[model samples]
Structures are given as structure tokens and as C-alpha cells.
Target: MLLELKILFARQAEQQLLQTTRDFHSCKQEEGQLVSSYVLKMKGYIDNLERLGHPVTLGLVLGKIINELHAMLKLYEQTLPKNNAPALHVIRAVKVKKLNKHKKSQPQMAAMGQNHGKGKNREVYAPKPKIPPPPKREDPAKDSICHECGETEH
Candidate 1:
């Protein structure tokens, strides 16, 4: 009976160790989560593993952190401009409108035939007007000559 009990306890300990190892390996930093918090969470897992008689090397921890950071950098790069251009140029290149939650409910009201009046007096949904881009100004140096040098460069 004593030998059987010892074997059962050993098997349980092994299973717990395996589960802890799996948890540590599968941990990942979520989007918008702070790096410090992610690191601390990983540290907790590492501590648990250590308590379970599993030794974690510093190199392994560092490698996992570096790999995760690299992945996050790649994701950030995908959202930003690739070229070394001014942010204004990027903003001007894309035209995006903010979506209003209330605007969506308005369409549903229209679909349900909630017209306030008949014919000309009925409420009609008009598409929002597009905003025109700002007027471009010509460079003064391109048309004006320098008083001392007689050149357009200023």
C-alpha cells in the first residue's frame, strides 16, 4: 500500500508540472496590454514552474520576450506608413469618416416607414455632403526671384 501511494503521488506531480509548462509556453501578450504587465505575468508562470521543480533558464525567458516584441513591432509597422514621409502626407492620402452609432439607428427608423408627413412633407434621408479638400498654395520661392541673387531659391 505504501509503494502504490508513492507512485500515485509521483504521477500527480508529473501531470501538474506538464500543465504548468504548457501554460508558460502558451502565454502571450494581448493587444493594448502594457509590456511590464505582460512580463510580470510571465514571471508568475516561471515562478510557478520553478516551484514545481522545473528549472527555467534566463536565456529562454529573454528569447521569448524578444520574439513577442518582434511580433508586436511587425503588427505596428503594418498600420503605419512604410516610407520616411511626413505624417501630413499620409493623412492627406486617406479620407476616412468616423462612424456614428446613432446614425445606424436612423436608417432602421426610415426602414420602418416612420415618415412624419406625406409626399413633399415626408422626412427623407439625404446623404451627408462630402467635404472638399483645402486649397493648395503655390510656393512663394517658386515664382519670386531673390533680390540679391536674382534666383528663385530662397
Candidate 2:
């Protein structure tokens, strides 16, 4: 009887572990959720998993956080105007794994035995400079011209 009871308890523990693992894997940040709250929720799942004898690495947690943040940023971009988009600096500081390639890589001509005058030889990524829009002309008469009707006053 004691052996049977022990086996039942072991089965129950295994089931609990499985459920916890499922919960951890299925956790996702909902739309419009704050980043801090999402991270806290994930941390809670991590804690639960750890308590259930499953170990999660710090790297895994951080990667998960970054992935969620990246997804949120993309969603935000679609809804927000181009001018309101998040700055590249913030994303770079977060060290997100992937970014849209804005600038093409070009090989620089360098002389032999010279490291381009820089201490280290490495590729640098920089955001493209923003150019202001051309100034608008203030000719009301010119603006009033209609090609189809040939009328200066609409």
C-alpha cells in the first residue's frame, strides 16, 4: 500500500511539472500590455518553473524579454506615424538581435599595413541622417491653378 501511494504521488508531481512547463512556454505579452508588467509576469512563471524543479537560465529569460519587446515595438510602429517611431538608439541599447537594414554595407579602400587609423578593425553601424523636407512655396496664385479646368481660383 505504501509503495502504491508513493507511486501515485510521484505521478502527481510529474503532472504538475508538465503543466508548469507548458504554462512557461505558452506565456506571452498581451497587446497594449506595459513592458514592465510583461516582464514581471514572465518572471513569475520562471519562479514557478524553478520551484517545480525545472531550471531556466538567465540568458533564456533575457532573450524572451527582448523578443516580446521587439514584437511590441513592431506593432507600435504600424499604429504610430513614422515621426513617432522609436529611436534606433533605444533599440541598440537594448541589444535586440535583429534590426531593419537601412544602410548598405560598402567596402572601404584601405592601404596595406594600416588599420584605417582606428585602433580596432570592426564594422560600425550608424543610422542614416534625416533630411528636412523642402520648404513650401507661398504663392497662393500658383497653388490655385488647376490643370484640368485651367482656372486660377477654385
Candidate 3:
């Protein structure tokens, strides 16, 4: 009975470790999430796996972190030492540049209002030019002419 219980406990630990590993592998940093928080989240999964009796190497964790980070951070990855564990503090401290998301072609949606210092009120307004409507088309029946028979109607 003791041996059976031990096996069951070990199997449960192994299952937990597997689930933790899967979670860690599938973990991805969401948009606007800070690098520190992202690293900490990954560390949490690694810690849980370690506690479950499945040991993960520092190098493997480092690789996983680098792989999961934005491609823009690839330049920073090259700077890390090949063999040693990555410095989480330094990685978290480094600010990853976010892509400029604003479209240049988009028109400004709102104009700023101005306040006048004097008691007299003067409203400033920008007038938009009105677009002229397209010219009306002539009747197709009236305009139709067939040159082959020299006839006004087909």
C-alpha cells in the first residue's frame, strides 16, 4: 500500500510538471505588457516546475525567454553571453522599443479650442470647402447614334 501511494504521488508530481512545462512553453507576452512582468510570469512557471521535481536548466530558461520575446529584441539577445544564465534584472531593465502604430495618412479628428483673455468673445473657426456635386448625365436615348446605318436609333 505504501509503495502504491508513493507511485501515485510521483505520477501526480510528474503530471503537474508536464502541465507546468506546457504552460511555460505556451506563455507569450501580451501587447503593452512590461518586460519585467513578462519575465516574472515566465519565472513563476519555471519555479512551479522546479517545485514539482522537474528541474529546468538556467540556459534552457534563458533560451525560452529570448525565443518568446519580440523579434525587435533579437539585437539584445546577441549581446547575451553564450554559456551563463541571463541576468533577468538586466533583461527586464532594457526597454524594448515599441513599433510606431499611428498611421501618418490619417487626418486629425479634432481641432483644439482657443480661449481669449479679453472680456470680448471671439470664436475661431476653420471653414471647410464644400465639394461640388457631379454634373447631370444626358439621356442615353437622346445621345445615341448609329453610324453604320446613319440612323439616330438602333
Candidate 4:
């Protein structure tokens, strides 16, 4: 459960990092500097998380990092300039947006086996073909008998 939450958080962070990279690249030189720096910090965290094979530890670290960043964002809000963004503010905004998106994307229960274990060959579960209900029982009056032999089917 904790692991599921953590993986979701990490994925959201990854998406935000990508978004920040795009936004930073779009900004003017001075403005872009902060975005780039923020992107680097986030990329480091993301890369570490990606290399993990399990979710529990990665999720805990990411959750802690996320909370710390939230705190830092509030504490450093004023660090941003009126016309230019500060590195903290850019990263904080990206983190907030990414976490929100992460919440929305993840299912309530952790996916059964989204991560770990070498995948195996398996048969698909297509439903069996339907067979029509057995034909209605024959009635002597409604069913015809064989003309000569009088066999039931005939």
C-alpha cells in the first residue's frame, strides 16, 4: 500500500520534471536558468527512483522528498522575483502539479503486478463461445414422426 502510493508519487514527479524541462526551455535565458537548475535536481531524484526494482523504499524516499519540497516551497515562496522565477518556486510549482496529476492517475489499490518479476507468457481470457440453449423438448402433436419407421428423430 505504501509502495503503491510512493510509485504513484514518483511517476507524477517524473511527469512534472518533463513539463518543467519544456517550460524552462521555452523561457528567456535568465528565466530559463532557474528552471534548468530545478529540472536537474528533480531529474536526479527521478533517476534514482526509476532504478529501483521494488516500490516500498522508493515510495518512502519519494514521499519524504515530496513533503520536504512542499515545506521548502512555502518557506521559499518569497524567493521568486516579481518578473523572474526562482529555482525553488519553479520546482515547487512543478511538484504540486505533478502530485495532483499523480493522484488522479493512480488506481485506489496498487496494480496487481505493474512492477517487479519477469513477465511470463500467458493465455488470453476471452469468453467461451455461446451455445444456444438446447432445443425445446419435442411434443408429439408439434413433432412429426418418421413416415415409415416412426423413429423419434425421424
Best by lDDT: 1
Residue-level lDDT of model 3, residues 1-154, one tens digit each, is 9999999998988888888988998898877788899999999998898888777899999998987775537655676675453354334333221111332322332233333323223222333558999987577766678768767745
- Ten contiguous residues minimizing lDDT sum, candidate 2: 96-105
Pitting candidate 2 against candidate 4, the one with the higher lDDT is 2
Task: Show where candidate 3 strays beyond 4 Å.
Answer: 72-154
Backbone clashes in each candidate structure, one number apiece?
Answer: 0, 0, 0, 0
Candidate 4 lDDT (Cα, whole model)?
Answer: 0.54
Residue 20 local lDDT, model 4: 53
User: In terms of TM-score, which candidate is strongest?
Assistant: 2
Better of 1 and 3 by lDDT: 1
| TM-scores for every predicted model | 0.50, 0.53, 0.44, 0.20
Q: Look at candidate 4 and give me any clashing residue pairs.
A: none
A best-first ranking of the candidates according to their lDDT comes to: 1, 2, 3, 4
Pitting candidate 1 against candidate 3, the one with the higher TM-score is 1
lDDT of 4 at 77: 63
CA lDDT of every candidate: 0.74, 0.72, 0.69, 0.54
